[model samples]
Target: MYLKIDERIFRELFHTYYDRLYTGFYKKTGSYEQAQDLTQQTFIKFWRYRDSYNPELSVEIQLFRKGKLVFIDWLRKESKERQMIDSLQQQEKIPVEELSADLKDSLNQAIDQLSPMRKEVFNLAYIEGYSHKEIAEKLNVSVRTVETHVYKSVQQLRKILALIFIMLHL
Candidate 1:
């Protein structure tokens, strides 16, 4: 018998897939909270795009594909923005570095915490002045993934440094 999925069906799907989706994303992105956010996002996308359902196909499969695509697309966007920010940071165009040695060191420390891949991406783009294409070829990943990693890394670095500043001042 074919199935008819309603709002309740979607709700149940959300609960059922939440942990699996979150775990999959967390493995790729290496953040618990980010995984949680992406899990919620996957469900959100499922709700918004529910009309695309094909009852002939498995509902679980549809949901899983959608969630994975959403996560990948998000990562791609985040990486590009990170590359841009890396360029901006390299220029020291702002007076932020002029603030204090402690602040600068804290910022450096947080950057130092990133995965080797992320650090390499940032360094090649900003410090070594490598193009995204070049970085992608060197890293054996698509340039799009490179951009996503860069964006997420920069965003994470910013948040980490901000918290460090607060803690240092306190």
Candidate 2:
């Protein structure tokens, strides 16, 4: 069935439900700004899909469903962003020259054992402080390739350092 709702009815529906929707979103998100944004987006979706409104269902039910979907998408996006930030933070926490002299010597040895290309990539990124994009441009390779080289270099260094630690302990 074709559903064409009048602007007057739509405005009335929005006015009646706006507060409840905003309050629900605010309770769920715990941020006034995010609640306001999601609430506005919900109404925008309702306005855009007004023609699809099912007369059999209440407008409130349809709006709630759309709002729930918007909230879920926001949550997933937030989770991914949080994970990226945490990963970057962990990488930044790795100390360079602050290690003990022996550990530093071992680390230098570990780095020296990497393949030439991997060693260059690692030095450019960690010591020289070049970003992945900058390293890619400087080395004339894809950013993904630069990242792979750095990743492999780090893995090899970790294994070598682990062995050194074990031998020192023994």
Q: In candidate 2, how many Å is residue 37 off?
A: 0.4
Which candidate has the top score in lDDT?
Answer: 2
Q: Write the per-residue lDDT of candidate 1 for residues 1-170, one digit (tens) a residue.
A: 43556788887887787888989989988878778888888888878877767878888898888888888898897787766856754654334436577867786798798888888887787557787788999989887678777776777788888889788889
Cα lDDT of model 2 by residue, 1-170, tens digit: 85677899889988999999999999997878789999999988888889997888877788899899889988997787556534653666455768889988998999999999999999998888888899999999977578668767777888999999999999
Off by over 4 Å in 2: 93-170
The residue pairs found clashing in candidate 2 are none
Q: What is the lDDT for 166 in model 1?
A: 88
Stretches of candidate 1 above 4 Å error? 1-4, 94-170
| lDDT scores of the candidates, listed in order | 0.78, 0.84
Which pairs of residues collide in candidate 1?
78-151, 79-147, 79-148, 79-151, 80-147, 82-151
TM-score of each: 0.52, 0.54
Q: Give the TM-score of candidate 1.
A: 0.52
